[model samples]
Target: MGHIIDISHHQDPTKMNYDKLSAQLDLVIVRTQYGSRVIDKHYKTHHREFQKRGIPTAAYAWVRGISLNDMKVEAIDFYQRTKEFNPTFWFLDVEEESMKDMRAGVSAYVRALRNCGAKKVGIYVGHHLYKKFNLNLNEVDAIWIPHYGKNNGQVTSQPSFPCDIHQYTDKGRLEGYSGYLDLNRLMGTKPLEFFTGKEVVKVDKKDEIKKDKPSDWAKEAWEWAKKEGFLDGTRPKEPVTREELAVVLQRLVKKLG
Candidate 1:
């Protein structure tokens, strides 16, 4: 697998070697803005450059709102500004405690993004605040947690929580840039398609029903099973799982008893 790096105004865009950088990257996450007020100056340039090289790109905005309204405003601004770039995912970077009730504020921000027609939204949280904020994890499509260990450009430790992506180090060095960079790795079972909006869920043939209706020979039995509440009357041609079989057997035994 290639590398995933995030860059902002700090990582001077002019000095970056696009050709070399594009060769080594699986994806690039560019900062769009810091809340609603301060936009990242180099965001557009970074997006254009990375996209020119056919590299997959995503965008993130640092959340800095103190109120629910502020969070919504920031979300709208972030989406409006970066939507033209067509980022694979829009991420909210929540680090500092900008609001007293972070859970409510962050939830508002995520909802705002959803209203803005963003199909894929993710959040990046400081590892330390993972348990402290207690934000609703189900609201977002993915979670990215940062736990830089040793900070020597190598991934020394992983985050303790379950996350979709992990930012292993902030001092990471790559050939395309002179300064340090934030490096991330895909964690758990999520594939790259999950982030890129190209995921094709594979269904097992055994799990799928061959036809909409049951075969003539089994139609009567299927109807009887459904009438008896032993089966759900769906997917008549599908193979039953062991658990389902056990449940049906138990129901039969109970009826006989």
Candidate 2:
């Protein structure tokens, strides 16, 4: 794919430059600072500079230690400030293992975000947290899965609760970024209007994905895709291999369409 990228302030300033990055990436997710005691502060320049860019952008918030009672307070403190960014998507970073009121906290954050006019409120969690929760994901609008398998393993393929994106690695180095940042793919959640109350527009190539994963299919389908050149085991970075993309698209056009 062309110009695929991710952004987070957690990188070393000595390593990454925002303006230089804006020149390359077509889409970037700028991490926002949390105005709370429990959250970590992100780079302010990252936020300012991403907004200045002409690219399609989204934002993420650190949603640690949130609760239902603090819905108003949390909503105001956490997400309200990000409204300045008319984000096409928003993500809640669920990297905690503390398990302190995790369910209520997650539900409240998701609900509050939905109520906040976000076109899509995304939940991001690593594979461990995901399996631990084993929570009925059908309730959540969409999922952002983070799996950095050196061998490049695919995550689960739930038919109903189809994931929206996959973070193939957390140790990615890119053009403008100075430190390791997430490298993700925009997976499918078609009829985006259902949850977002928006209209059906043409889907971007990254978004026109099928729910079929090699690990999710029958033994034959999986093999056929691979033999026919669909699911190649490769790590993701700023720019994906178009050759691989073409193979996946060819397979999906038949399997998905």
Candidate 3:
């Protein structure tokens, strides 16, 4: 409804200027730098500042790659640290240029966070990538789109609301980086989770495995939940059972109608 400003130290905090940002934003997602990037460093200092200011906040990372390995590292670290702050949601800043042909792995990072017990997670993508990746909107959260495209909403081809936040113009000419950051009011959302169905590829990581494979219908149900915003992420466990499978199928069919 108000705004969801993504705060990051790497971007220059003074550029944010909380006095101005607070006035324009409702939710502040500070980059805790949770991922496995030891080269540079960041902390939850901004999250504390926002909390003191009484702003609803969360944390995220500049996710570089979309592999299960990349997610596993960041997911474990981000969750372990944020047990204290306990923000509203988590995000994988799916930046452009960095994400190329990794569409299939988009769900990897999200799944990792889910496995670590992250309740709410979402993507921060602009128009360029949303279109570039040929996104499956039904399986993900609303886009944190930042664009000046004349017909921005036209391309998505869904009912115009595909985009949640619009970083209308970065480097706000007026506030000097205190630009307009719009967001859709998040409703009925929860933390994100991740579970793996793929084979245990690593010799050392054989512990995490679902003995039986999932049926076609069970996998279909998963896809459905993801698209409908019911599923947060995946975890490693035995395949969905016939009884559990029946319940999900019935629910989905009812929802479809």
Candidate 4:
């Protein structure tokens, strides 16, 4: 049972008394960039302010990719900006029809972040885009879905996935800020440290962080794939086709069974 908030350049950190707001929130996700070139004006301000108050922080990059190659480039740019922040989590903000091939574009973006050593990469998407892209969400660590209601900060239709976080309202009123803010709830029991990349004891804060070790299911699938020669003894730094993916999945399933 935790409360979280997302802020962009729209939310003025200087105007809001963070000391007062910190009491009401456990974590903050700041918007760091919009695509490859444009940096969000308020990102550094909000990030520093939130950390100054000892609130856990993460980051999201608003993606605008016109094609798979474009998305990969944008992702690399995003990774460079956010990697310095050492946020417990990082998310790709997916909206609009910017990507020409939605599936390949999205997949490339996620893979790029992983390659950049983002330990806890996630996706921020609405239900419509989720289904439209038929996104293979298992590739990422978290899913943040947004659903707002007609009334003040109330959510009418809940997201279908057991979301790690839900942005329930955009019209939320807070005491320290004059304008409405995006409000979220963390659905899982993992505490703020879990999201902040601080849970691991041995890692140095400044070093390039790798994603947490794979889950038992993922390990099993990997072992099965390797045993059956499905991986072909190479790790590709490039994207794989859907047909190739289907064959691998089918082979892994049969081997596991």
Candidate 5:
């Protein structure tokens, strides 16, 4: 299995060797923000550097909201900043006792993320508080529970509860880094694609053609535009920009002239 690790400003990018780290990592989940405020200083660099090396990446935000409204605000802030990166998943790192009703607060956070168009959402709960918090797990697409068996830089025992991903060690040592890194493992029968949302599917050629080709209603006009040298017959299913429309209009005007 490919190694997975999470990082924040704690793992200084300037000191860390990304060339070695990127070769070993299958996924990298970077912390986006610490709450509604205080965006992680190295988040953008971490995301870009890993992604540049062709490793899939995800984003997580430490949940520090005290009220339900605060939870929503934090979620919006997390999405707004990290959405441009198009992370495979957005995770809520709920570790501290922020609110009286954490269940409701966590649910609100998930809902707000969904409202802002976040498709794949997950939660990372401290293993000790797994049962104590009684978080609304149903709201998320995946659950991540941390169980550092001895925190001895090795995976000793698995998390007691069922989860999509497990953070087995915080003091884990890897070949690329000299310091401690949070190392994770994919649990149970779920494949890596389940978390990355990159599941491969077999498609029939006929169905592919039907999806890519122009619809019957637009076929005649589409052909006419192409034949008349006004429009290029490519990317028919893609959106048209103002610049492309202007060019098309110019071509049509010249043709008529």
Candidate 6:
């Protein structure tokens, strides 16, 4: 649905105009850090400039570690540094060096990130590397695949797996960019909320507020949901299971339709 691009220090930020690029691209993912301590030199600059130009941005941290504890350290460091930027999506760059134990390593990194309260965590890997490691792709919120064509950067063949974003070519040329740049394609349409948390909307508190009301702000939403048959017939105080929540969502979609 939209044109997306990924960049790091490898591409010179000094040469790229954030305003022009923002006009041309829908989204951007910048490299924030590597391992635990090494921050990308251009990360803060890119993040700030992109935001100034009103461009939506996300970030990825390169995963580095030999063990689970090492991965946890890297996750903590990553969360501390990039949490300030508040990327629309946070991804762990999983490449050959980080895939030592393969499945367990990936699991450890994802778990550490979740523990650190990172939202919308995703994985970035190549097709060959994914198949080689037999990665459990379900561990993250989204999958980013980098598969160039038969030759390097040609983009002749399609990736064999379902992916949310595909890095199709590394030989892309964009205005304001000095040389070739990495290009990505967003496969399906998703709102910015799919990556970022939804915006909080303020609602009025009227005389109809009840003693066991959810939240003063959520009361209106709850009443609408209940009236539309999106809720089970249970009382509002009852807890919802994962299964019940799913059914409610399905019904809400049909109601909206």
On TM-score, who's better, 2 or 6? 6
TM-score of each: 0.77, 0.60, 0.55, 0.72, 0.77, 0.71
Measured by TM-score, how close is model 2 to the native structure? 0.60
Which has the greatest lDDT?
A: 1
What's the CA error at residue 151 for candidate 5, in Å? 1.9
RMSD to the true structure for each prediction, in A, is 13.9, 16.7, 19.0, 19.5, 8.1, 14.0
Better of 2 and 6 by lDDT: 6
Which of candidates 1 and 5 is the stronger one according to lDDT? 1
lDDT of 2 at 23: 80
lDDT of 6 by residue, 1-257 (tens): 44578888887777887777778876789898878767888888888888787777888988777788888888888888888888888898888666468678878878888888887888998687887877687878888888777535445657788887878888877777777888876555655457545464655565234434566777787888778888843456557899998998899788788
- Which pairs clash (backbone N, Cα, C closer than 3 Å) in model 6? 149-155
Model 2 CA lDDT for position 169: 65
Off by over 4 Å in 1: 198-257
| Candidate 3, residue 171: lDDT | 31
Backbone clash count for every predicted candidate, in the order shown: 0, 2, 16, 2, 0, 1
Candidate 4, superposed: residue stretches over 4 Å from native: 188-193, 198-257
**lDDT of all predictions, in order shown?**
0.91, 0.60, 0.57, 0.79, 0.91, 0.78
Clash-forming residue pairs, model 2: 15-178, 16-178
TM-score of 6: 0.71
Q: Where does the lowest 10-residue lDDT sum fall in candidate 6? A: 203-212
Please give the distance, in angstroms, between residue 255's alpha carbon in candidate 2 and its true position after superposition: 62
lDDT digits (tens) for residues 125-169 of candidate 1: 989898999989898999999988897888898899999999998
